[model samples]
Target: MSSNNAIVLKKYIDPTEGYPKIGEHFGLEERPFNLEATKVDEEHPLLLRNIYTSIDPYIRIRMQNPKYKSYLPSLGINQVIPNLTLAEVVKSAVPEHKTGSHVIFMSGWEEYTLVPKQAMGMVQSVNNPYNLPLMTFVGALGMPSQTAYIGLKHIGQPKAGETIYVSAASGAVGQVVGQLAKAMGLYVVGSAGSDEKIAHLKEIGYDAVFNYKKESVHEALPRVCPKGIDIYFENVGGETLDAVLLNANFHARIIFCGCISQYNNPNPYGLKNYSQILTKSIKVEGFIVMNLMPLYQEEYFREMPKLIAEGKLKYKYDVYMGLGSIPEGFLAVLQGNNFGKALSKIADE
Candidate 1:
């Protein structure tokens, strides 16, 4: 038996209380985990050494009580906090999964994990022709890209020469949404938190970009998008959303991807300009990417990689090193401290 170090949930979070401080809700610990000792003949298992893990906003919603349920299950207190991870299979009892093979699955915030055979179906092999970095499987080519594709193509339904506004434009999903909209010949404007992010958006071909922290979205939107927006990719909800509603064009579409701004707020701001939805005949749809996976996963896998390879799509990552960095990395993402997709690099590829 060897000691396994893992980050465990220390307590259930109160969503109304806002973002958690380090060590307040999560902490690291070491425990003995013997794969051989715990073997049951009916169960198939694999030992995994995690290489990279994603720190996403949705995980925050799961940290709260079960009564505040989500599409996913809540994290159990004192248990290892599971995340979408890329790992190498070090040992396996199942014939289908071979040793030394790399796999992607939901694993804990640990140096190593013992995954059951029931979860094998959820595990995906990273072997592909794209020649992209493995970490991208958890970022761009993974949920974020899928999210962008499904929302924009299905809900937003953007048209050529139309205007699209994206909030939290530098985030993993927002960046992809903006790029995809532009590829469809729509004029795209993005709002980010800082000057650096604003510049990055322009470098990647956003028609216009603004710093939401400095400029009021209400004022800046009218100047940048003179024609009013045809599609608004809503990522940061609060005031930014209200401003978009005020300026939305007739028959505009609003895809409610996330509400990062209100995620931690005790009392989230209500939409004052919601009346515009009725007047403009706006189609406001809130969606979870998983709900549309069966319909769009194949299309996403085929098109997104080609777009990235052709240089039509661009992505950025704010990677923190080591397993110990997971807490701070998660906190950084929630606080807008990270510039792009937030990830923790547990080991070298």
Candidate 2:
């Protein structure tokens, strides 16, 4: 057995101070660890070599102290920060999980991981029946896609002929939400920070898209959706939320998926148009995708892949190579530097 490389938290990050610098809070190191050594019982242990690891903005919340408490647990100091990862079972004591089986699981930012059979329930098999890239399991066909599906169907409840507005439109979850809205016959508009991302959204069939950095969300929403937005898939909060409230139609649905804008800001922006929620009888709800997992897992797996195969759904990947790239990838995602779903290619498939 050999030592594996991983990204370990060097110190607790202060969210109020702003974005993290690579080496100051996180560092990569090699540790003496092996899969077989972690087996609880020889009968059903699995050793996984991670291939792809996702880097999401929400992970920043976990970097904060436990006192800041979020729905998800915070990462401990000097521990390997875990994220959704796609791994190949290199060795397995279980009959059902064979060596070479690709599985997606909650694992650390490490080259390899060991899990007992009891924890196997968290491991999802990557069954790519459509021959799509295996990386899709970490993006479109993975949690982000599920987040989009559940939020839209269960929360946003969009209908055909309705107008849907998505902030962070080119991001992992936002991209899917826009595409799904379009497929369901709703008018869709998206907002991204850069011209490149805006163009990508348009090419993928968004009814309209704007470079939010160049144009105000207040101005863009009405220009794209004159009738007012019926569904606001809220990804970036703060000013965007304020604008959405101003343009929201009566009984509008706001699926609050994330708030990247306020994640790092100590003094987060306050919404002035919140009064519209009451005046318009709007439904504004915040959700974490994990809570809806059991209810939507079966349906999500059944439909999302089919949509991807049928060409009704599309996704993009912003991939960083190697485990050492984890910090860079994470920072890029927080800063909205990467387009689409951000991931790190930990190893070759």
Candidate 3:
């Protein structure tokens, strides 16, 4: 009805610098977009009212200045940050499209979006036959589970009866990965940042979970996974990676997901046991969810939602209310303060 508010980057975060202070890196801007005044057409695009957006550690990578090349475009100064969002079509030009239809699309961390028809490949109409929460479209059933599905299948290549270790196992992606591993008949062990997260992971089918903050990863991994890690679902890099390497079985597979521990560092902590990969014949590989989504997304939505709705799959995320909560929510995610996947809710209904 009125002008919109969007979170904009105030400055490029240099890798040489530390984590941004609260309210220093991003600012909310009131844009001149008024749905009441604007014309709508193919070029003008359909206006979407954003409902929920996925806030992840990868968003931290987008904050960095382009001192080096990255797969994702770095957020530009004064530009609205972009994320995978679940939104409602408030206005549309298409004759077949109806107002209030929900679609999952990339939205500029704002109240509303103008997604053109050309971007249909990136947007999909919401098909929720199970009456599940829409936020799952942004969290578990969305990028997080998609990442877990692809990375575990393609990268880890896990086999039944093998032991798997997951770092940050209570986060959005890790939870899915761990649960999937359990379903495949693998013994699942994971490390979390807090006792509460560890408890959640255990309840969700993690055979073993430890608080890595209280106990060192090197100590915990060996104790929890005495069989040795055959598939390492890597999320927390740095010392955790080294610990995995130390405790990994011969020919173990390491699925390199995000390294949240080192996201803010200019110079990341280098692994000391570099030769372990060669010695153990380990397969260490990295994947970006964006690159693999096209191939696996259909499979993800087809199966994951049914499992989640049936209570066969467990997932977790924290949604901060309102557009105003974006900054604090994002910062909490970056600092590992969020219990689960952190997201911002704009207008769910």
Higher-TM-score candidate of 1 and 3: 3
TM-score of each: 0.95, 0.95, 0.96
Model 1, span 205-315: residue lDDT tens: 899989988989999999999999999999989999899998999999999999988879999898899999999999999999889988987778888888887777889
State how far residue 83 of model 2 sits from its true place (Å): 1.0
How many clashes would you count in candidate 2? 0
Q: Which model scores highest in TM-score?
A: 3
Q: Which pairs clash inside model 3?
A: none
Clashing pairs in 2: none
Report lDDT (Cα) of residue 302, candidate 3. 85
**Residue 230 accuracy (lDDT) in model 2:** 95
After aligning candidate 1 to the native by TM-score, how far in Å is the CA of 249 from where it should be?
Answer: 0.5
lDDT of 2 by residue, 212-267 (tens): 99988877888998889999999889999999999999999999999899888989
On TM-score, who's better, 2 or 3?
Answer: 3
lDDT per residue for candidate 3 within 252-326, as digits (tens), equals: 999998788887876889999879999999999998888888887778778888899889887777888988888
Candidate 1 error regions (>4 Å): 32-42
The TM-score between candidate 2 and the true structure equals 0.95
